[model samples]
Target: MDSGIGSQPLQEETADLKAPIAEPSINLDNRIPGLDDPYEHALKPNGDPWAILLKPEMETDKIQCDAWKEEVQTLLIFAGLFSAVVTAFVIESYKFLQPDPNDAIVRLLTQIANGSNATSSPASTSFTATAPSLRINIFWFISLILSLATVLVGTIALQWLREHQAYPACSPKQTLALLRMRSESLEAWHIPQVFAALPLLLQSALVLFLAGLIDFTLPLGPKISIPIACIIGLILVFLACTTILPSFQPLFLLSGRFSRDSVPSPCAFKSPQSQL
Candidate 1:
């Protein structure tokens, strides 16, 4: 019986050792729910999600977008000059159409009221009536319309250039290659340089038109009116040469054989030639 009791104790010990110990119950509920994966909180301390997720390609895209913004701004400035010239043309046209006759009438009345012997001459009236020619008016109107059309074309071209600057499907490398090709062709032909200069030419034409209109309509004698018109013309020319021309100097220099080799690739994201 003692031997049987000792064997029963040994059997109980063996059975306990053979049984699987329940892994300390995991109790996922106590895990604070979403914190189960340690890597889920991998964001930097500043917590800027974009900064953390940004890639090389995204950085390149941002640089390209910035460069496009600058080019658009410069082109807009050039286009604005066209609008300014158009405004000046309209003002001069209005002045020519509705000249002030009150000054002459007032002078005549003042002489009559003062009982002066001076008589109003037919020559002065004839000159006033014949000053502005119908042909000149028609020419000025047509030129104004053309100037406006030029401005419209420039704006449209700028928009098109912006669209062509980048494409979503294009790999950055391919996009850069295309940008270089375009720059090379444009530089070789120097087309943009010529286009940029058109504003100055149009401004000169508009100024000359205004001077002629003023010369015809002004009540003052030719000695005074001619000099005034000349001064005004000079001022307009000065402004165009000093302000607009210098602003576009860089664009003008962006072409030619020297530029083809020396000019940096148009794409801001492209590696430098030396690096390449």
Candidate 2:
């Protein structure tokens, strides 16, 4: 051969041109589809357990703060109401103690004089009775008005607090499912709450009315009857509350409902029966 221009041996050149091909190794662990995004592993259509837990924890803190504020307001309203009650008692007591314009003996004498001495009768037989002590009446009236105003204001405040935006006790992914759940199931428990409030309100009004009536009608010497009456009324109220409480237990237990997506939903405060 002519050596084809360059001077290397053919076998050496051929051997240098040949390169070995390496086989690719397969990874079993990395082959998994969701491995790159682990968060997808924790979520489901219904919701993740962790998210559910987080929802309640966050809402609880906010609920607790709201409830505490409501308690403070309730206390203030009660204090104002108490002050009003005391003022009413004082005003009524003073009015009772003050001399009455018409005495039984005076009335009897006046009647006789009017019948027998018609010609000599005083020019004006009319007795212009002074109005109940203006100062005391005004104080009692203002106290009552203020107390009522306080209750109204407190009620408005409570309503505003109730309206504050609340987050579901579950993750956002499951929020739709929670909303789909028939919250009407919760009606069973709410009836008792409504009825309970009614009775309590009635009892309060009755007690207040009785207290005022007793102060105005009964002399202080035999006031023990009022306490006894109040005790009886309280016993009735307690009985009613106890009866209603039992009815509420089942609703309270069912408060945690499963959403359509199977996530645990927020606890309902009122029982289902109340919904009716």
Candidate 3:
């Protein structure tokens, strides 16, 4: 055998061995299309869940804190102003608690002048505060105290809100967990209930003041007292309706809409008359 003919079979075998082999005709993708990458990615576990879950929780905490802070601040301002006004009224009303010497001297002088001009003796004056004055002072003093108390409550609420917003230095995950815990504590302690009662306290003080004012004015006769009473009663009615009717919501719109009204929303069920 010459080299050419003898090497032909070997050359053919070499050519066969050199042929390109098919790669992975049956691969992971072949078994199930497009599932392998997700399985691998899931096993790796990225930071997406941390951001996605915690972000809303943190934002919810912030929104609640800001809303309460603003409301408390506004209530504080009203309480301060109301206290000042009530204090001014108290300053005048309290003087009636004790007999004023200056007032007595003036009354004496007036009686002396009247006695000299007329033949009759000047009638003895009662320097002591009458029942109406005592009642008036009591009501006004209570109102002033209540207003101050409201201010105190509002201040405490502000502090609570501030403390609620505060967080320890920590990682984001820890921070969010801490916030949730604090919020639960806040509710558990009835901080929201305390906040809810603040307005009611303030309103009670105002009602007491008005009651005292009405009592003080009643001596002026029906001409003065009737109109004053009517006006005050009207205001009280309006305020009461406004406060109570909001609780009824879609059931009672006569008091107008509130923060949680369904004024714009259509009724879910049509009436039989409407269907007709």
Candidate 4:
């Protein structure tokens, strides 16, 4: 009976040893999932998770760059149109004064003297009649040169952007570098655009002033020419400032960050394993 009891205990112990240990139960709900987990979709072959995240950022940057490029193209077109207008106007005004170019030239000189002496002589009145033509020619000449410069610089920038777009940077580091370089180049190109506006503003103001001068020279009494010219000048100034200023904000932000001699590497955050 004792052997049977002892054997029973031994059998129980043997049974306990043979039984599998109960593993601690895990709460799947509380467990954080990882990208490599089987439940998640598999990554693409040779694909980088970091690169995938960066894709959207790169796309956004590309969109902004394209928009800026279009803006520059529009500015170029406007510059060309302005150049054409100035050239045509100057030519026409020169032809109009050709009957006696010396008369307009003499009139311009006389007017400068008359500015010092408020009272005008009979000869001064005759000279004043031709002064508007000379002033118009001079102002338009300056405007033409400025507008042409804007067109030239804008064209160069546009072509460079096109080429860059065609042969884009292959890697993220290259892309970041290219974007920074393009922004600086764009800022430089924008200088001509902003300066072009100054000449345009001056030319428009001169146009209005000439209208007033011509009014005095005309047999007819004061007319609406000055008011009309003033309105035109205001419109040109508004358009130029509104279009150019917004572009500057973006370029300024971009350039200010990368202006230093030592640019931070885009791959600085990458792991040594990734580099290998």
Best by lDDT: 3
lDDT of each model, Cα atoms only?
0.57, 0.51, 0.76, 0.58
Give candidates' CA RMSD values in order: 17.7, 17.2, 12.8, 16.5
lDDT of 3 by residue, 1-276 (tens): 598899999999999999998887455554553412334336236664545677899888888778777877887898898888888888887887887768656766776776664445445567677899999988988888888888898897888787778778776657767877898898899887787777777888999999888987989999999999999999898666665544455564555545454445544333222221
lDDT of 1 by residue, 1-276 (tens): 989988998999999999999988565656554412444447678764533343454566557546544654564565467557656656665555554678677767777788875565412543243335544566566656656655565566557556645455654445555655765665687545545554544554566566556745466688778787777878876654555544444566665434465744432322111111
Winner by TM-score between candidate 2 and candidate 1: 1
Q: List the residue pairs that clash in candidate 4.
A: none
Q: What local lDDT does model 3 show for residue 138?
A: 89
Q: How close is candidate 2 to the true structure, as a TM-score?
A: 0.32
- Model 3: lDDT of residue 127: 69
- Candidate 3: worst 10 consecutive residues by lDDT? 267-276
Candidate 4 off by > 4 Å:
1-46, 96-130, 166-221, 224-227, 233-276
Candidate 2 error regions (>4 Å):
1-64, 67-73, 76-84, 87-108, 111-132, 165-276
**Shift in Å, residue 169, candidate 3:** 2.6
Model 2 agreement with the true structure over 77-189: per-residue lDDT tens digits: 67466656656576655654455655645756776776866335333344432433444344445545545554554565455444433445655545534432323322444
Which of 3 and 4 is the better model by lDDT? 3
Task: Summarize candidate 4's per-residue lDDT along 17-38 as a digit string, tens digits.
Answer: 9999999977678668763455
